[model samples]
Target: MKRMKKVAALLLAVVMLASTAACSSDKSWAAKNDSLTVPIGSYIYELYAAYYSASSQTGDTAAGSASSQAAESSVLDRKIDGKDAKTWIREKALNSTKSLFVIDRKMKDLKLTLTDAEKASIKTNTDSSWANYKSTLEGYGIAESSYQLAAAEYSAKYQKVFQATYGKSGAKAVPDDELKSFFEKNYTDFSYVLCKLYKTDSSGNYSASFTDSEKKKAEAEFNDYASKISAGTMTLQQAADAYKSVDSTISVQNDTANLKTNLQGYPDDLVKLLDGMKAGETKAAEISSGYLYILATKNDIAKKTADEMKTDDGRNNLLADYKGQEFSDEISKEADSISGVTINEKAIDSYDPSMFAAEK
Candidate 1:
């Protein structure tokens, strides 16, 4: 996850420069022609990462047919549910690009207040994350003050948006009980293995992309991996370690996510696949041609009823997760209303999503 982010920082400075990042917005974005402009700012760092990740994972699934081709070679092979790769990546990029702008604008529009501590923490986290890749950032001409300011206000901005929608009390603070209730109703704690399939050469370079034959072979490999988990021969971590070889492409990572069933945050195919799945079930799901060998360590049980949610002290800690989703949806909705949010197609086209792929 952090790998793509490092690659993104390098791309944004070179590819997402202001001259290309400034694009025109359509109706909801601008009521009058040229009245509203979406400019390139520090936000591109976030958007670039999102677009890159989405494009890599989704591939060309978005195209009407698997063979659908775009002139831009960058996305010629990628998909997002059969949609065009460029189309999908651009949409994701646009959302990340517009998120901060809308959040800050709405904060002013609603006159929300941020507590002093919240302000300080945002800055602190932003500075820390930035420092990890400070050289890459500065190489791209990102000023420390600019990066810090964007990083610092991140929490405060989103908190304001979430509070507005959830109807929080203190300037926009959500009541703990109601927040807990939302959590109890929304999320399920689960862990999964994201098995990204590829064919590796001796040099550890991903040589063969997922083709029809590769997909079948990859499925077999993942099935065996799943069998190991079911038989208790290996845990997910051990499985990840067990299969890593010089010429294998089935890279594994064990991840835990408190996923939401009702939200359309990820692909619908993914959400539906997990529905009613029980713990101890090792299921395989293919996204595009690659595989997601889902060994569900937990499942989405029943959501808490109104009263049950209020009294569910066990899950109160999940409030942050629900709040975060609500905030993201709000920003997405705001972007949706805008008829036009133009990206520099030429600039966007120039980017190669494979830069994040396994290198030799």
Candidate 2:
């Protein structure tokens, strides 16, 4: 009977050991599943995570670097560092999340309510934006799921913000004082010359399109204008107006800050040239489309009195501080309540140019 009792006791110990091992295994499985969930509070954080995953997986920082080095398509690059293009979906996702958060919080503060129409507008805008985002990503050979994930993350994060802020009120009208201040701060002086050149593009080479002969003549004219200003023969405004006589439709507006609100795709070189020159200065810039004559004009803004300036500055500082506080409060609350947080290290390391290779 004692021997039998010893055998039974041994069996009981084994059973208990097995049960403990099973329990531990179950816990690990649960944790792994939980880690697969992504947080939905900030698209920026999601993008950062995504980029980190890609960067970690490929051991190629060049994926991101290639984007930065890209001149026109830098918009598509997802580079975290160096010369790669930063991913637009990731960046916009982060921005959308932040914007939604801010808007939602504002609604809560103002006790505003969102109407059905407003909600519809928001939904429509969101849908449109996502569609554009996906299309753009596809053009660069990025996976559709990746783009969808980005939009999803942004939607989830901003929805929470909307619920809290403008979700109730929809769109809020800008206050007069606020609008005026924004306008004044952003408004600046600008000038441009409109020219009509007989167009020609040769062998699909834009440079070659402007035959060497025509280029020489245009360059000479540009130089003549530049020399006139340097010699004080004519001001930028005078030169542009004079040139307009050659082509009545080719009027030049010099030393003006306000551009038509509809002028899209303004050349960056023009902006830079304008900013670099004095009010009376003239510069000739060559663009892919055609030759441009730009003139700089003086800008005069009304300065506030010392006291007034102080008051304005102080108000701005206070407003900024309040915004910071509100954002922190809202984000902290959501973060604490977030259910899933993940970091995909392997995916990030593998995120280099090699990923762009044909799938094996």
Candidate 3:
């Protein structure tokens, strides 16, 4: 009778162990939609990315270098746009997951597949990342396969959808003449030599002060450079070299091709000047609140050949200026439209961003 009791007890223990294992398996999934189960590891990977991205945006120096506990605390203690950092990060990660789902669904709908070259690139990138962060990721309970899955979503699937929607041969390809016209109107190829009239501290913080003599000297010197460039007496590079020789503190940025309208880091006055100036014409002006004097020469790429407009660089600029926002909005809309998806809050809540903190 005692032997029978022992056997029964052992059987009960086995059943309990199996039940616990099943629960763990369920918890391993972060979300589910119909037959699809999104792994907790995948969500965790996205969370890790979102945390670091937010950290970088907020200029948190300890973001990628801090200890796991410190990293976690840093994000948790902060607020982004009036939202708690933890909540913000979690929402960002989940939204990224939804985007991945959209990418996958769109790729299927479009009958798109990654080329062999694209597949190879993804593998190479994933292998490198996995090798570098394997230990940290494993500690955070992220498997290599999960990381690869996320990487593929971003690198391959997303890009394929974008190309299918907007490539030269895509259904929604912009007309060549329209792209050319947009390029001509909004893009400029130019070079400039800037003589800053302000003083800066050791940390390069500019102070808006220049003596009358200093301003006069800068204006005269820059105007001479501009006249020489306009007369073809010196190339833009030569002028830059000459200016640097005369005033080592002067800033010269030549060969600035394909400058778009209202580009950051360029003064509004300079953009306006470029707009009015013809190709091969050189002009000197005071810009940046009269703190900078510039000698600028516009290049003759305002009217490029049709083939030139079809180059990779040209296409990229168009995407950045035109179709990129449209694509992003479309993806966001698609992600929002996905239905029957449910989050495993229990699983997600159990994970933490600090678990994948960078190793010191």
Candidate 4:
């Protein structure tokens, strides 16, 4: 009957509509492997991060403008490290997403599970971030779940993998002795009292250089303090305190520890001098083209007590420095070896980095 044919046609139309909707959803996935499915939103999150990272490296401050036209043009037209900015951003996002996938796969292979504390930390961090940037992130089409997936969850997984590979009881643990040797060779611990040869105005602005007599007096005082410290009559902290009392312009940094050989703030000559000095040795150095003088004393890191090493977890930082690059290289190797990764170019091309640039 005609009525029966009409009903069958209507059912077929409904089925076709359902099928199309399902296909549309599938197309929204940015990537996937046998065991992992990366949502489009997660890919967008990676793109967002890559965009900002490139912007920061190229010093493209205008990329964060409210005007989408300006921000998009600025970012799209830029070049980074000999590559087009848009291309760099896309490649970085894709590679970073693959890295995340590798991390997840490795974590599963290694039977690694985040601790309850870590889970709570991730939730707390994600919740805090969502609270602060909910509107801005949502405006970029990043859902709360995708932000959690790409940010805190991804970070926690990476940390877990790093620890499993390098922790004290890890399968590839570096021996304590080796770590210590690396620490001593690559790190420096020292304290200093700085005497500025420039005078300050009432508002504490640099006004004038010290007279030759003032410079000589400052140098003589620092040399005397260095002598006292070298003689063991005054500790470095005691000398710093005493110098500050005498010259109000003096700045004292006591027990500054774990400074790498490439020390910042201090001049290159001073860093070279510090590198060559032994523990318990005190020296007076003219830095900043003789505009300032410092009485510096190098400290022995080998003598750090267990309790002292726990202070600020200096030991952990040292371990990170010693093994961080090696661990990263290993992760990159494993990530590259992973097979069956498929990226949805259509889904990726649907979005643009400029879409995120309008966000503050």
Best by lDDT: 4
Model 1: number of clashes?
17
Residues 1-360 of candidate 3: C-alpha lDDT, one tens digit per residue:
999999999999999999977776577888777656778889888998888887876667676564656765676678888898877887788887777777777777898878888888888888987898898888778898788878764767776777777777888887777777777666677777788787777777976588999889879988887888778788767777777865576555754334464545576788889889998899999998888888888877654545456688757567557677788888877776688788777788887655545545
All candidates' TM-scores?
Answer: 0.44, 0.41, 0.71, 0.77
Q: Give Cα-based local distance difference scores for all models.
A: 0.53, 0.45, 0.76, 0.79
Give residue 79's lDDT in candidate 2 (0 to 100): 51
Residue 68 lDDT (model 3): 53
How close to the true structure is residue 12 of candidate 2, measured as C-alpha lDDT? 96
Model 1, which residues run further than 4 Å from truth?
1-43, 59-76, 139-141, 149-152, 167-317, 320-326, 338-360
Identify the leading candidate in terms of TM-score.
Answer: 4
lDDT of 4 by residue, 1-360 (tens): 999999999999999999977765575588888888888888888999999898877777777776767776777778988999989998878877788789888899889988999999999999998998888778877888888888999989987887778877788887767876776666677778788888887887889999999889888988998888788788767776777765665565755444563535668777877888998899998898887888888878666534344643665666677787787777667666668898887788888877776665
Ranking by lDDT: 4, 3, 1, 2
lDDT of 1 by residue, 59-148 (tens): 523322233233234443456678776566656765655565566666777787677887778777877887786775554344565465
RMSD per candidate (Å) reads 16.1, 10.7, 6.1, 4.7
Task: Tell me how far the alpha carbon of residue 13 in candidate 1 is from the true structure, in angstroms, after superposition.
Answer: 35
Of 1 and 3, which scores higher on lDDT? 3
lDDT of 3 at 288: 87
